[model samples]
Target: MSKIIDTAHVFFFVVGLEVRQEFAHGALRDTSRARLAVIAGVASVALPALVYVLVVGAAGAEGIEGWGAVVGTDTAFMLGALAIVGPRLSGQLRVFLLTLTVVDDFLAVSIIGIFYSEEIRIVPLLVALACLLALWLLGRSRQWSAAPYVLIVLGLWLATLSSGVHASLAGMIAGLLIPAYPTRRHKVVAARQLFRDFWQSPSASSARAVGRGLSRGVSVNERLHEYLRLPTALLAVPIFALANAGVDLRGGLLVDSLGSPVTWGVVAGLVLGKLLGIGLATLLAVRLGAGRLPEGVGMGSVFGGAALSGIGFTVSLLIIGLAFGTTSDLGRQATLGVFVAMVLACVLGWAIFKVAARRWGEETADLPMTLEPPVDPEVDHIRGPEDAQLTLVEFVDFECPFCAHATGSWEDLHERFGDDLRYVVRHLPHHPHGPIAARAAEAAANQGMFWPWLDFVFTRQHALERDNLVDYAVELGLDVETFTEDLDSAEVAKRVERDAASAADSGAHATPTFFVEGCRLLGSYDARTLTAMLESSRRGTRTQEIPA
Candidate 1:
C-alpha cells in the first residue's frame, strides 16, 4: 500500500510537471495564456465545489455528517511540481504557469473556507489575524531573517490546522506573503551580471549560466524561493502523498465502493467537470479577449492539457477525507475517484503534450526578471503563566470547516465550564479567509462582543466573506461604522498578528487545535472526547487543590 502511495506521488509529480510546462510556455509569451490557465483551473475546481454546496446544503448535510464529501484540487502537489521543475523550459511559460498555479491554490482555499466551513472562534481567528499582520509587518520592510520567518510560516500552518482551517491554506498564505527576490545589493549585482551573460551568449552554456545566477549571494527572499521551489515541492509534497494516498485497495470492498454514487460524483466531477470547465473556460477566455493562442501551441493542445486538469488527486482526496468520514462509503468512493481521475489525466495530458511538442518543435523561452521584496515573520504572542492554567487555548481561522467543528465543541465547553475556563484565542487563518477573516475577528473583539461574534461565525462559517463579516457585526448590534474601520485598522491587524505568531510558536498547523491544561489535540472532536478531557482536567485540578 505504501509503495502504491509512493508511486502515486511520482505519478502526480509527472502530471504536474507536464501541466506546468504547458502553462509556463504560454505565460511567458502572453498574459492571456496565463489568465486562461487560471480560468481553467478555477472552472475545474468550481464543478465539484458547486456540487458540494448545492447537494450538501439542500440535504442539510452542512453539519458534520454532510459536508464530508466536498472535493478540491491539490494546489501544492500540482504547483509545487511546477516550482521544482523551475523555469527551465521557457522562462515566460514558467512564470505564466507558476502564477496560474498560485492563483488556482488561492481560489481553491477560498472556496473551502467561504462556502464549506462551519463556524469561527473569535479568539483563534484573532490570533491567526495577528500572525498574518506580523508576517506582513516583520517581512514588510524585508528586514527579517529567513529562519524566524520559516518558523513563523510553519507555526501558522500548525495553528491554522489547529484553528479549524485547512492547514494547507496556511502554506499558500505564507507562500504568497513570503518575498521571493534578492534582498542584498551584492546578490542583485551578481544576478544582473549572470542575466547579462545569458542574454549575451544564448548558445554558449545555458545550464552553467543559470546555475551561477542562482548561486549568487544569499538573500532571505531568494532562500525562501529556493525553499518553495525545492524542499516544499519536491520533498514535502511527495512525502505527504506517500502518507496520505496509500489505501488498501485489495479488498473487494474497495472495488465495490467505487461503484457508489458518491464515487461517481467525485470521479465525474474531476474527470468530466475538469475537461469541460477547463476547455470551455479557455475558449471563453479567448473569446472574451482574455487569452490567446500560444505561438506554437493550438486549441488542440490546450484541450488536451485541459483534460489533464481532470487529475484531482491530492486536494480531491483531502476533501474526501473531510467531506466524507474515513469509514464511510463516501470516503471509499472519493478515493477511487481520485485514482481514476489521476490515471486518466496522466494519459490524456501526456498524449496532448507529446503532439504539441512534436508539432511546435518545443522551442522554449527565458524567464522574466522578478524584483525581490522584503520578507517578514508572522509570530504569535507569548502567554503568561496565570493565563496558562485552566486556559482554553484555541488556534483557529474564520474560514475553516474543521475550525467550525472545533467552534461547536468550544461552545459546548464554554457553556459547560462557564467561568472556570479562561479562553485564549489565537489566529490560524487558512486559505481564502486567512487574512480577511482574522481582521474581521479582531474588529469584533474591539467591540467587547467577541464571544457572540464567534458564535455567529460558527453558525455561518461558510459565509465568512468581507461583506458577510461586516454584516455579522451589524447583526450583533455593533457600531457598524467603527467595526468596519477596525476591520482594516493597523492596530487590529497587529493584535491578530500577535496571536498568529503565538499560534505558530505553539506548533499548530491544522485548524481547531486545542491545548486544554497543556494537553494538545488537533482537528475536530466529538462531544464525548472533549467532555472526557475536560472532566479529566477538572479532576486533576481538584486533586491539586487537595494538597498532595
Candidate 2:
C-alpha cells in the first residue's frame, strides 16, 4: 500500500509540474523580474528550513532532521485558497506566485533525494543516469511521438527506485527535460491542409493522417500536460492524500503534541518564515534594481501572496513521511502542525488582502480594463470618419500569424458597417521582428501610406528582414531616401513604444486583442461574434438615450 501511494504521488507531482511550467513560460516576460522571483523562491525555502532547524535545536528535539517539511508550498492547496481569498483580478500576482512555487518545489524535492534517501546501489544508479541521457536525446531530437519518452521515463523511475534514491526525483528531472515551444505557423498551415484533405476523402487512413498532422503541430510537453492535468488533480492527488493523512488522536497523543517542540517548529517555520522570507526578499530585489514589481501588482499583493505561500501541505506531508515513519509519534506531531499552519495561513492571507484593498485603494490586481488615453482622431491612424458612432480598436503585431488571420475579420466588419464604424490600429509587438516591423509601418505612415503598407506586409510575413522592408517601401512608391531615414529615427521607435505602453495599460498581452466601444472583447473574435457584439453595443447606446 505504501509503495502504491508513493508511485501515485510521483505521477501526480510530475503532471502538476508540467502545468506549472506552461504557466511560468507564458508569464515570465521581464527577465529581471524572473530572476527576482527565483531569488525569492530560494529564500522561501532556505529561511523556513533555517527557522525549523533553529527552533528544534533550541528545544533539543530529536526530529530536527524534519526541517524539509516547511520547505515547499502546496501548489494545489495554495492555488485553491488564492481563488477564494485573493484579489478578484490577480493575473500578475498569480504569475509571480506560480514562478516562485516552481523554484520552491524543485528545492524541496532535491532535499528529499539528498537528505532522506536510503543507501544507494551503484549499478541501478548508473542505469538511471543512462535513462536520463536517453530522455535528453529524445527531447533534443524533437520526437513528437509520446511512446518512446514514456517507456524511457518508466524505466528511469524503476532504476531510481532500485538505487534507493527517492523515485519522485526521476519524475521531476524527466518533466523539466521535456521540450516546450509555441506551434509554428508553417506547421499549423500544414495541419489545416491535412484536415482539408481528410474532409475531401472520408476514410480511416485519411483520418489517421489528419490526427498525426494535428499532433505533430503541438509540442509533446503540452500534449501530455493537457491529457494528464485533470485526472491527476481531481483523482490521483486526492487518493494520495487519503492514503498518507491518517493520524490517530486517541488518548494523550493530542495533548502531548501541543507541547512537542517539533510541532511548534513546523508551525513557526511555515507561518512566520515564509511570510518574512518571501516579503523581505522581494523588497530587497526591487531596491537593488533587480526588477520592479509586475504592473498592477503592488507590494500589498506581494505580501498577501507571501502569506498564502505558508500552506505547505502536500510536499510537507511527503517529506514528513520520509523523515519519520508515518506511524511514529513525531510524525503525528508534525501532521498536527501542518493542519494548524494551513488554517493560520488562510486566515492571515484573507486579512492581508482585505487590508490591502481598503488601505492601498488597489482594488484591481490586473491590467486596467478600459483602453488608456482614449482614441484621438487627430493623432491615431483611423480607417473611417472621426465622428463614427462605433469604434473598433485592435492591438496588432505584424509578425504574428494570428494577427494576419484577423485581417479578414476586420474587412468583413468594414463591409457590414462602413462609415458608421471607425477602426484604429495600435502596436503590441510580441515577436523578435515585431518591433522593426511596427517601426517600418510607422515610417510608412509618415509618407501617408500606412494602410497600404499594412496590406502588403501581412501578405509577405515570411520576408521581413531589413532589406526586404526597404524593398517594400520602393514597391509602395514612397520616397526611398525619406522612408529609410524615418525607419531608423528615434521618433519612429518612440511611436511604437507609446502604443506598446498603451497595450500594457489596457491589459493586451497577446497580439490581435480587440476593443469595441471602449470595452475589451473577452472571447471569440470571429466575424459573426464580433458583429453580434457590435450590434448589441449599438442597441445599448440607443437605449441609454431614451430617458427614464
Candidate 3:
C-alpha cells in the first residue's frame, strides 16, 4: 500500500499541481478566455467519456472498467508537438490550447480521486482535513517561507495516504490554497527612491537585500510552481515514466493483447474521441456566445489544433496505472494502444494543420509605434512637479524583468528633465508579487515615506520577502509595526486594485507599459531614445524610430 500510494503521490505532486495552477489561474477569471477554458475542460472530459462508453460496449470490454484510461489528453506530448507549429500560430491560439490541456488535467485527476480509490479510514481522512485547514491559515498569514508549508503538506500527504485517499489529492489541495494576492503589493516611489539610494551607496549588502525584496513580490504559489518546474520535468516525470512505462511487449502476449477488446477501445477513444471532443466543443462555445475563436484562427485551424490534441502520452500512461492492473496482459495491450494512437494522432494533426495554414494564413502586421493609455496624474503616484508638461506614466510589475531594465533610468529622468517632467507610477501587478510591491508602497505612502520604500523595492527588486520588506522599513526609519499593519490593511489593497482597474481601462495588458502625454511606449528605452520620444510626443509628431 505504501509503495502504491507513493507512486501516484509523486506523480501528482510534480505533474498534477503544475497543470492545476494554470487551470486555477484561468478559472479565477470570468472573461471569455476563462469561460472558454472551463467549457473546453468539460467538453474534453465529457466527449471522451461518451466515446469510451461506445467503444467499450462495441468491443465487448464493458466488464473491464478501463473507461477512464481514454478520457485524458496527454499534456506533455500534445504541447511539445504543437510548439513546433507555433511559429505559424497566433499567440492567442497557443494560449487557448495550453489552457484546454490544463482543464483536461483537472478532469483526469478528479476521476482518480472519485473512482480509483479504495476503502477509506475515517480518522486519517479527518487528519488530512485538519492539515489542509492549517495550510490555508499559513497562506492567509502570508508566512512567505517554504519550509513550514512543505512540512505541513508532507503531513497531509502521509495522512491522505494512510486514509486510503490518493496522496496526490493533497498536493492539488495545497496548490489551490495558495494566496492569490500579495500582502500589500506595489511601491512605486519607494522602489525609485531605493534605486537612487543604491546607485548612490552601491553596497553589496543592500544589493542582496534589494534582490530578496524583488523576489518577495512574487506570490507563494507562483514562486513555488516556477521553482518546481525544472525538478518536476527532470526528476518526477522521468522517474514516473520509467517505473510505469516498463511494459513486457516480448511474448505472443503482444499479438494476443492486440486482439483484446480493451486494446481496440483505447486506441479508438484517444485518437477519435479527442479530435471530435475538442473541435466540436470549441465550435459550440463560439456559437453559444460563451467564447470566440482566437484572432486570425478559422474553423480549419481549430480542426487542426483539435487533431493535435489527440497526442496523449505522459498522462495516458498515468491513467493506465490507476484504471488497470499493471501486471495484467490487459494493461500491457492498453499501453500499446496509447503509443500507437499517439503516432497516428500526430500524423493526422500535422496534415490538417498544413492544409489549414496554407488555406487560411493571415499576414502579420507591424506593431504600432505607440498607443494611448489613460494618463490621470490624480490617481497615480507622482514624483516631479505635477504641472510638468512631460508626464510619463509607467504601468509596472516589480517582479517583471523589463521593469527592472526601466527602473534604472526613471530617477535619472528627473535629473535630466528637472521640473519639466512629471513621472507617474501606476500599479499593474500581473506578477504575483506585484500586489505586494503595491501594498508596501501604499503603506509607506501612509507614512509619508513612499519614495524611500519605492526606492528600496526597485533597488532590491529581486528580494521582496516579508522579513525583507520589514527590514527595509526599519532601515528607512519608519515605524516597523505600523508599516506592517498597513501592509495588510484593506485600504492599501483597494488602492492597488484601483490601479489595476485603471490599467484595464487604458489597454495596458502587458507589464512595463508606459504612456507619455497619453501615447503608450513599450520595451526598455535608453536616455537618448527617451529624449527623442518625449520630443516627438511634445511636438505631436509620430516618429518611426521606435518599433511598436
Evaluation by lDDT, superior candidate among 2 and 3:
2
Quality of model 3 by C-alpha lDDT: 0.68
Could you estimate the TM-score for every candidate? Answer: 0.50, 0.86, 0.63
Model 2, global lDDT: 0.81
Off by over 4 Å in 3: 1-30, 61-64, 85-95, 182-212, 293-305, 362-508, 514-548
Q: Model 3: how far is 186 from its true place, Å? A: 4.0
Residue 256's C-alpha lDDT in candidate 1?
A: 73
The TM-score, computed over Cα atoms with residue i paired to residue i, of candidate 2 is 0.86
Q: Model 2 over residues 180-207: C-alpha lDDT tens digits?
A: 7776667878988999999899899999
If the candidates were sorted by their lDDT against the true structure, best first, what order would they fall in?
2, 3, 1
Backbone clashes in each candidate structure, one number apiece? 63, 0, 39
Best of the two (1, 3) by lDDT? 3
lDDT of 3 by residue, 384-498 (tens): 8878888777777777655623446675666677888877777888777777878888898899887667776776777877787888899899988999999999999998888
Higher-TM-score candidate among 1 and 3? 3
